[model samples]
Target: MGALTPEVMVRSLSQVLSFILAIALVLALLEGYVYLLFFRRPRALLGAIFTRTVQSAIAALMLLLFLRFLDRMGLIADLVAALGLAPLLTLPERVWAAWSALSPMPWRLLLPFFLILALELLIYFAGEPRPSRLGLAYVLILPALIGISFLIIIPFLFEVRLAFSNMAMYTAQNPEFGLRYGIENFIKVFTGPVAKDATFFEVFGRTVLWTAINVFFHVTGGLILALLLNRPMRLRGLYRTILILPWAVPSTITAMAWRNEFDFRYGLFNILLRNVQQFFTDLAAQAQSLPLIYDLLAWLSQAIHPVPWRQDPTWAFISVVMTNVWLGIPFMMVVILGGLQSISQEYYEAAEIDGASKWQQFRHITLPLLRPVLVPATILGTVWTFNRFEVIYLVTQGGPQEKTDILVSSLYKAIFQFYRYGFSAAFALVIFFILLLWSIFYLRITKGLRGVYE
Candidate 1:
């Protein structure tokens, strides 16, 4: 390629600036729309301020694009120094005039100053007319951040506004929702499913039970496995590899695999069942003279029967709990193994010198020392298992009957299958409170909070 000409660079800079100005104009228009339509500000100043800031930001972007297009990174810093710091430049006085006149809002000065500073940073990073290799890739990043921040801020504000109102789809469609503000949604969440005639207390109780049962089994099973593996035995490595496999595998896959294994017929369990024909043939052969064996067969025939493990209530509950408990152990085992290794061997040695039994040593020394690890893990496991839907859903589809359904799946069914989104949202809010209250109660009870630096 021939050496770059001044005319080519100027043309590129013009195109970049034009593109930047177009985007700025669009953003300023959006600011006015959001302020007037969504926020409904009593005064127009907020819209004007937002629009002006956005326009400035756009201009900064244009400058950087020009520098980057011209491949002149150093030129940008030099220009900023020359323009920003030149003697008797009158730049500060011009900037002060822009700030004062840009918005007649109460925050006019503060808003414009921050906006101008933000624009300056955007230009410095973008490297518009001259490109730094580093700055070229990042030229558009600052404006993008600003755009994303608007997305979050606007939605969050609207949601908060909605929280204080009785708005719905019909009302949200209009610029001014006809519905009035009230505390009814909050009250409704506490009272129960208003349409179903069930009280909120009932659902809350169900959630509490659900959380407790899952945590109980998870902790018990995990502790048992961890204890077993900690002991020295033959084939220890192989045993650990197999035992840890359940947690290493995805819970969704494991749940489904176990589900198929529990099928009533044509499953592994049923296929392994002893054929009655063999027993009958043996009985016939022995019947000619073996009275004692005949008597034993008669006795044994009355004792055992095939269990409908998933079909029946007692065993069905057991099956879900067992599967979740099994799924949880490997994670706990891995975490607990670290905790166990950290225990000072000196404690065990002292206990042994004092003639303490292994059980006594564990109860006295290990349990207390393990509390730090166990307490946090227990809390996390409880919360996660309470909301664990995939494992249980994939396992039973919350079925045989609805006996195994927990709050999360039940809420999902209510929303998706029944199309009661309003009710489900209310229910979700209730769940949030229940968890919050539980966490607070836990802290009060245990005095263990997050990031306790000491």
Candidate 2:
């Protein structure tokens, strides 16, 4: 009744159609450029590169244009309306009427169809399909490449576009929002008022610290447990099950449970500490000779109040890290355990004959052998912990005054809470570059991807 009036929708549809036709026109020009490059010039290495680039670019443009055309064409809507699909079938007549009213964009859809048809005809008259291995590969691979391009590359391009534009919530709701491209969003991320207080650098450092601490503990704890479990011992299965139970539980539930346990007053942790303090007090009082124990207990109990784990910044950070480490270890433990089982016992036996101690055997044989498996697992764990949002959010909500806010959580706040889409997108791109650079550096340093040959 309000904004669903036919006139408004028709205008919006007109604008959308105009946008599509414009894109189609551009694609047609690019296709013509491709034809000129290959058909007119004798084939050369430089020309081949140019031709390939133009072809790929034009193909991507056509695919995106086709999708937008189909969406605006209301093909899905028409099919659903005809078939009376579930949920749509149960909708009231007024809803259906409104949908039908809003769906189509007049005869403008014919523009793209005719433009494409003309391009195909031109190509058909100019040349026939050649049967080459390269052509065959293109036929097989182009669909998958196009799918990935649409799924990943296009959205990434959109994010980059959004980063450059002033596309906040206001502009987001308005389809005719004008493009205002500048480095303003990037500027704000680094030097704005938001950056002045708790700078992006600080958040980034804390994030690095968070990732380092969590991964260190996860890798070490998991490796230790994995080693223990890998040994031939009785009740190893039971120990493994009990150790891995923390990871078996969902992270949200685990975070909530840990949050309660970390509570300051009458929480499980404090209660247990109080009981331990009481036990020590009783024991020291009964043994009158060791009065230091009684005095120590009195002083300790009086001095150490219940920790405000979630309310204090340092403790809040520690709380989430602890919860994450617990959640993360079991996965690494399983990975390292598998690596350990795959190692030949003959290596250890030979080491034993060479008078190598257990530590020597582990240092020489175990670690070297486990490196191949652990390297990629470590990288995956590092990336996951770097971007982990759930534990941080659910545990402390990035508080005691945003002290624990990592990049991803900060991005969530900027975009969802503050509606600063452009700024958040810029911030996200910075994070992406940081991670990308680090990953490249890490892979180069480790050379983990070396093939079986030199």
Candidate 3:
């Protein structure tokens, strides 16, 4: 019993079945006509294959539509989708296996006719929610929820479509097949300038450089500091605390602090330079103002001077990389320090007994043992730096010109600045595959065949 009774439900469901039958019949007839008109000549050699595919597809649609109508009509009251009780969908899949392929329709479809007749005679009046369960609404809405699974699969198909197709509607006249977009975009991604005049590949390459250089300095410097702090020296606790201060401070604050410190005027750097330049004597001579790194470049370019640091392309690139390296170091230092603590003292003692030089011990023991932790950290650091926009953008703004745009920042420009959703989506899809392919390649190379982990 429901707000709408079983009788009312059956009446409404009957009408729905009639409506579905009409639609199905119309579509089948229309597609059949279209196939007769257009799909005829292509069937010269593959006629059997084409016919089989068409017939099989059509039969499947018909069977699903029939099952759906039966479910609607309360001919099968179990509503757990393919798991529904009493009548099941497997009847079609199973019984159809024995039917002749050449037949117009599967002889197995006859089973449904008798089954439905017997169903109507039996308790066709049974209701849902498993008959004893409390949630009738759950049962009623179950199929709609199942339908959404297919809905979620659509965007992936669209991305795949774009990946394969040239995608410009104006490319040619009514092309039957997907046009040859080629690996041109893919190649462009790795080369330079993905779109228009701006070169994102160079930006991305610089980003990678930033990552590698940053990690190398960070690990070495962090390890040295960590080892120093680990010793039983005076004020060791205070020194350790001071060393970690850079990492513990918020990144934005640290970045702003560095930005101020690098200012052209009233900054420590210029003051220090002026003191050092005056033969280390004129501590009281008025400290000369050095141009800010970027400003200095513009000034020098005016005077047949050194290449620009922030405006000239090469200098601008270097400044950004240096800043990124500076920003990234503290984090790596902390991670390495943690890794160092986890290594056992026994290895070092054993190395000493074997009369291995410190360098030799480090080379053979430290590096090989550290590889397990460092490899993952290095790879993660690489990806993070590759996509790092905030640090570079806040500092460089891709300035002088659009000379410093990485793939992601460049993608941002395309989406918001250029209003190219499809283009950007395609770019994102490409990047995703690039990362996915790299991951797959790494996994294959690494062969993550774990034995046992507690």
How does each model score on TM-score?
0.58, 0.70, 0.52
The weakest ten consecutive residues by lDDT in model 2 span 173-182
* 236-285: candidate 3 lDDT, tens digit per residue: 76776777676677767765665554444554454555445443223222
Model 2's number of clashes is 0
What are the clash counts of all predictions, listed in order?
A: 15, 0, 1
Give the local distance difference test score of model 3: 0.57
lDDT values, one for every candidate: 0.62, 0.74, 0.57
lDDT of model 1 at position 149:
52
lDDT of 1 at 412: 68
lDDT of 1 by residue, 401-444 (tens): 55566677767665666554444555666676678988898787
List model 2 lDDT by residue over 292-324, tens digit each: 776776676566556778678998888888888
Error of 2 at 12 (Å): 29
Candidate structures ordered by lDDT, highest first: 2, 1, 3
Clashes of 1: 15
Worst 10-residue lDDT window, candidate 1:
33-42
Reference-based lDDT, residue 129, model 2: 40
Off by more than 4 A, model 3: 1-196, 260-309, 449-454
**Residue 292 CA error for candidate 3 (Å)?**
32
